[model samples]
Target chain A: MSANEEAARHREVRNAWALSAPALILLLVAAIGPLFIMLVYSFLTPGQYGNVEWKFSWDAWIGTLYSRDIFDGTLKLADAHLTIFWRSVKLSLLTTIITFIVGFPTAWFIATRSPRSRALWLFLITIPFWTNLLIRTFAINEIIRNEGLINSVLMWMGVIDQPINMIYTDTAVFVGMTYVYLPLMVLPLFASIDRFDMRLLEAGYDLYASRWQVLRRVIVPIVRPGIVAGSILVFIPALGAYVTPRILGGGKNMMIGNFIELQFGQGRNWPLGAALSVLLLIVVTIALMFYVRASTKGTNNG
Target chain B: MTTDVAVEARNAVKAFGQGETAVRALDDVSIQIRKAEFFTLLGPSGCGKTTLLRLIAGFETPTSGQILLDGKDITNDPPNKRPVNTVFQSYALFPHLSVAQNIAFGLEMLGRPRAEITKTVERMLALVKLEAMAGRKTSQLSGGQQQRVALARALAPQPKVLLLDEPLSALDYKLRKEMQLELKRLQTETGITFIFVTHDQEEALTMSDRIAVMSAGHIQQIGGPREIYTRPVNRFVADFIGETNFLSGEAGEGRVTLASGDVVQVEGAEGRKGKVTVVIRPEQVRLAEAGAAETIPATVESLVYFGTDTHCHLRLKDGTEMVARLQSPASGEAGLQQGQSVGLRFAPGAARVLED
Candidate 1:
């Protein structure tokens, strides 16, 4: 509008940028820089030994979906690659759903405790986090293994002649992932449910809604942001999870993370590894975008 | 159990926490709300007015009593099973729903036909005069509009009775007055037995057809607005309903002898003796020149100038303090001075005697 006001506004913008410059520079160097390097390598040629070459090629990107035969040089669909991708997506979705089923009631319980004991309940929820993730995964392995506690107790009771072969399978991975990612779901759900107005329950009941209807129609809709947050928190990490699948799946079953790691280590294809890593990042980004959309829509309607 | 009685609470006692720490919130209270009447539970906070209302709504079960709806026992029925709804103190409209959806919620829960629900929601929106805000979220509304949506939502189900739990307390003064009239009109138009709960005496006096004055978990009195204001049965009801002067004296033959050797006529002291309390409303006391006939001599203590009336604070010879509301002249003050001698006269049949 005026020259003085314009100058002052310009100074404010400059000051804001100056204040944020450090964080912006750190993000670029620490986070986006490696991702940019991976993107560039995905477009380049793969070397004989385990790195990218200067020469450019689309072999790595093409190899992601279609594998070229070594002798015939004929292209065909990469069934193994497709299977790993499908398993990754499926297991991650199941993990999200299972964690939600177990976590919603847990969060509700913790949120409904009296003020003095609510803190204790929340502390108990986070007790598993005190230990390392790998250690916890191993602890789970100890229980469901062939000679683990469950099998030993059942065998001692003479109910089964043989121990169940639960280890080294998809079920093992699912159990381990659900165990590991459950707190992720519960914490956000707790945060939302704790802020929920208990009086709305009375209002819902007064409105002729059954208890089931109240939960589905009132409580779930109000706490939906927590559901979305918890789902994202579990789903994105579960999609690209490496440690649990590696330990629990026992090398026979592999997810996208192990497959990507195999390309760089044993397969010696750095470009393909980079391409797969970038693809996983894209999937996580899309999930986060949906989260943003859903959360914003929730607030707008709420 | 009469057909005219829409809801009845028979000797209801509600206690919170047990084993010696128990506090009786409603101590063996009984009340009958007639059909299509605007009955109010009025008292200060912790007087168990809300507890009584909750008992009727089936939110809180009585410890050892029965609640009835049209002569049917509903004591053990849950809130949802009862054909009643509540407009909460906070106007607890669902935040995620539009105004129209909030109104349609009860009908949908009751499994009404889709067309009927649509029609009822439309009519409710018009009843509260929020037709344009049907699509707006409850959070997007102002306090008064949210209040209307709460009303519409509760009324949409067409319950036999509507329980309002201090619903107007959240509104501002101007809006509270507007909604008071709006609530009265809604009750009249719907012809639903409205059980309203409030602490504000003025609100209860203005809106309710019958007021139940409560104190310390007991129903002190229940009567029409005029009856409760003019003919309170006890000191608590008289002091609680409005501003009043309480004078302790000996009563006999329709006359009271004050402690300071003055005599005054009280209407209800006939054939009574010994100690009693005289209840006289401020507006019923008229100030006149000193030493007038059939008057009590008093000294002016202070004068508060209200826009419509001037409150004259006075002290009697027996050290009893009293207030008289004098109408201010249109163009001037009431012309009363502090510390001046005056005579106080009670209007004919204005004073009632209560047991001390």
Candidate 2:
């Protein structure tokens, strides 16, 4: 090739690399580097001098597998971590299911409205998300506590003999988490439902399909993508949450977030803490993979 | 009760809003669609054509009317309980279902056995010539394919009457022409009463056995295509169906005299003598030599050359403008030029006298 042709090709390659360098480096630092650090820490052991050592060994993994007495006696191996993990999973699952049950009807109502009314409803849904997450959790706490609004109202109505034990329980955690993530579940589903064409429902009715049949066969399938997207939004955050559960669970009935906190805080066993973090990441990763596959199949078939 | 009328709307009065702002969409409109015939409601936009279609489909209830299908009064019935199906303009196919499942949806709603639903869906897919795409997603299909899938889905239920609301306007020009013939063929093969609503005059004229031309919540005329085109009942019908040269004149004893000093003989001229519009089709006007008996001297104003015929815009000395169609092959008018003088004539019954 001529010198000019060679120089043009080199310029094209240089420009392409230049344009992609920022994004590539950001990905490496924000995502890839932390994951590499976590993987290394997972294989490391606590040093004799009260710090993590760089020497690689499978001792942490083996200890987790075989040290039944120390791990189980302390209730962190199978019972404690497993219970916390399952609790987190259940809480997230319930949040997702409840959000869908509520969000679908809410989105349908909003979608059928006039443009001005729909805009107003959208503004209302977003107003709660504007405040800080801790503030919202605390607000929930104040409302359900001993001297809170429900107790005050019950006492005034003379229904209860004394203030009910309302705060610091699993129910409290569920309420706070659901409140925080309800909008997250609603917005995406609303987007999908809002774009739904009403003519299809009309067509369904004309074809002798009952209202229930139309909802089952047409509406649900068409809005599944939005449902999947919203479910993921609610499920992932509820799974890894520390603030809402910490405030609402009141430290006694702790979830995985508190377990992770105690291990790294007062417990001071960084290797076990790293292992638990790694386990949480693995669970989330598997779930995200399944979600991606299901969403892809839905779009492909549709 | 034993009559064979597939669908009938009796004095249907559908109004929107209330008080002064109310629009009577269908004002005492009545129509009977015979069994297994292709009936078309042809009108311009905002003429209540779609409203009428919705009323018959049971999507909307009329203010005061009785809708009967198969001799059963279905005036207050919901759409799901009616023995009718509609193909929407947008098709509205279930985006998440395959073509086979989309076609089988109604049968599934009816609680048909899975095997029966499958067999019927497959047959419908073949009928619409979309069996190969039965497994494909609706988005993967073309516009015409979606239209056929919609047709198959609606037809699989075998309703008493089928409604189509401008189903072909979404297609391209060539595909729409092809689908028009396919739709007619489907109607013949299935023997289903089709009530189609469209604003396209050509589509209505070509496909419908009988057409109701509606305007402003009123049906201007209802007849066969030829009769509606030739014998329009009023000036609105005449002007809406096709182009007509409206020569305002005074009617007298068996003759009408134009303001431009031209006179023409017409039938039924003695009944109304004040004023009338002489409706003449472009092709009916004959170009002849300057000395014919009924000929009037005219000057060619403009010449438009169509592929098959040439349209000559003429202006008489009395300031009446008229158009005549001449068969010309060449690009330039053969032996005709703007500003040239000629004589225009027509047969005795060429023009239809109409009330404005």
Candidate 3:
């Protein structure tokens, strides 16, 4: 290459890096810096009063799946910790599924509205976001509690003499997370469905495809990117959700987020908390990788 | 109930919206398409041609009338329940499916066996001459290839009747012409009843066995191409099919007297009374020297030279403007100029009289 061309190319590369330097520095300081600290803490010894010491040890990582008997120091399965992890993964998966079931039709309805009124329907979907997430979770807490609107209405109508116990259960946590993460699922679905060609439905019907076949074969495959985006958006945050479970499940239905908080705040095991936090990050990264694979496959086929 | 009639629409009316703001999209339209014939619904946009085609395809149900397939009342049948397919104006091939898969779609939906669907898909690919493109996605194909895939997909199931709603309108001029002939060849080879909808008059004339010219939700006329072109029943059909000169005249006793005081014989003016519109095609009018026998005096307004023909714009003495298309000479000259006086001669029995 000519020297002039090489010099000009080097200047362009320098300008690009110079423009991005601020973002790169901010990311290193504000994001990865704390994760580095957590990683280091996960390898160190936990102090007595909820802090980590400089001495390296593997006890915190081992304690993630096992705990020692206080008397004999025998390593055994961490039953309580495993239950919390299972509940976290299970509830998060169910929340993703339930949100999709409810959000698909809602997004389809909003996307099919008249152009002027479609804006109104989409605005209504996002109205829940204007309120604080904590307040919203608490509001759900009021509705499903023993004296909540559903039980009150059922009792008033004489359908049942006693209120069904729905609070402080896994069901309550499930309901709460689904409500909290529903809009996240719906918006991406709407963005994809809004661009969907309605004429394909007619074309499908003309081609002898029933409505159900059309949905499965045509609509679902075409809008899969939205499904993946919405799933990841709901799944990752729901896996790490804390406030909704705390408010609705009372004290027993602890998710991973609440369990990790317990290590730092009251359990006095900072290193274990750091390790659990790192584990959650790994789970999220794996989920993101699956999403990337799925979306790329969809593009390749299309 | 005749076996030759493939599809019949009886007084179909389709209205959009309700009450005060309702728009009548198809107004009491009735048509009978014969078996294995290419029938065209030709009109300008919003003229209800597409609506009629949709009614035949069962995409739109009639509001107050009946649609029949082989004497069976199919007005209430859903599109998927009917044995008919449509090639949409947009050629809405599923972008996710490969070319072969697209052709196999309708067959698969019909619950055809795997081996049969594969055989039919291969045959359809060969029919449309796209065998080499079977593995490619619909989005990867060119416009013409996508169009062929759409045709193959719609033709795979061997529907009793096929509907095409301006399928070639998206193509360029050259490709549109090529597909027109290609579509005709497909229809002939398959011997399927083809119901085509388009607004281009030349396309309808070139490709259809019969043409139904529509206007404002009404069928103006229905006949073969030659009949519709040479013998339109009214002014709308005459003006829409091609260029025509409408001269205000009074008709009686096998001849018509123009407002310019010139008398000319009209083919269909026999036994007609006063106040008629004379329909004369541009190609039927011949220009001669001024004051020739049986010729009307006119002044040449302008001339437009197309490759094969020269359009002579002329004005009658009564101030009525008319156009005459004359064959361009081999020497590349029309031998006519503006503002020159000329005699306009109508070939014997060239004019048809329409009631005013």
Please provide, for model 1 over A1-302, each residue's C-alpha lDDT reduced to its tens digit, 9 standing for 90 to 100. 99999999999999999999999999999999999999999999888998879888889899999999989999999999999898899999999999999999999999999999999988888999999989999998899899998899999999997999999999899999999999999999999999999999999999999999999889988999899899999998999999999989889679999999999899899999999999889888987898778776764323
| DockQ-based CAPRI category assigned to the predicted complex of candidate 1 | medium
- Which segments of candidate 1 are over 4 A away from where they belong? A1-4, A287-302, B1-3
Question: What's the residue-level lDDT of A2 in candidate 2?
Answer: 100
State in Å the error of residue A203, model 2.
2.1
**DockQ of all predictions against the true structure, Cα-based:** 0.69, 0.60, 0.69
Error of 3 at A67 (Å): 1.2
Give me the candidate number with maximum lDDT.
Answer: 3
Candidate 1 vs 3: which has more lDDT: 3
Query: Deviation in angstroms for A219 in model 1?
Result: 1.2
lDDT of 2 by residue, B100-190 (tens): 8889888878888989999999899999999899899899999999999999998998887889999999999999999999999999999
Question: TM-scores across all candidates?
Answer: 0.96, 0.92, 0.96
Q: For each candidate, C-alpha RMSD in Å?
A: 2.1, 3.2, 2.1
Show pairs that collide, candidate 1: none
* lDDT (Cα atoms) of all candidates against the true structure: 0.92, 0.85, 0.93
What C-alpha RMSD does candidate 3 show over the true interface residues after superposing them? 2.1
lDDT of 3 by residue, A1-302 (tens): 99999999999999999999999999999999999999999999989887978999999999999999999999999999999999999999999999999999999999999999999988988999999999998898889899998899999999999998999999999999999999999999999999899899999999899999999888988898889889999999999999988999888889999999999999999999999999989988997898778676865333
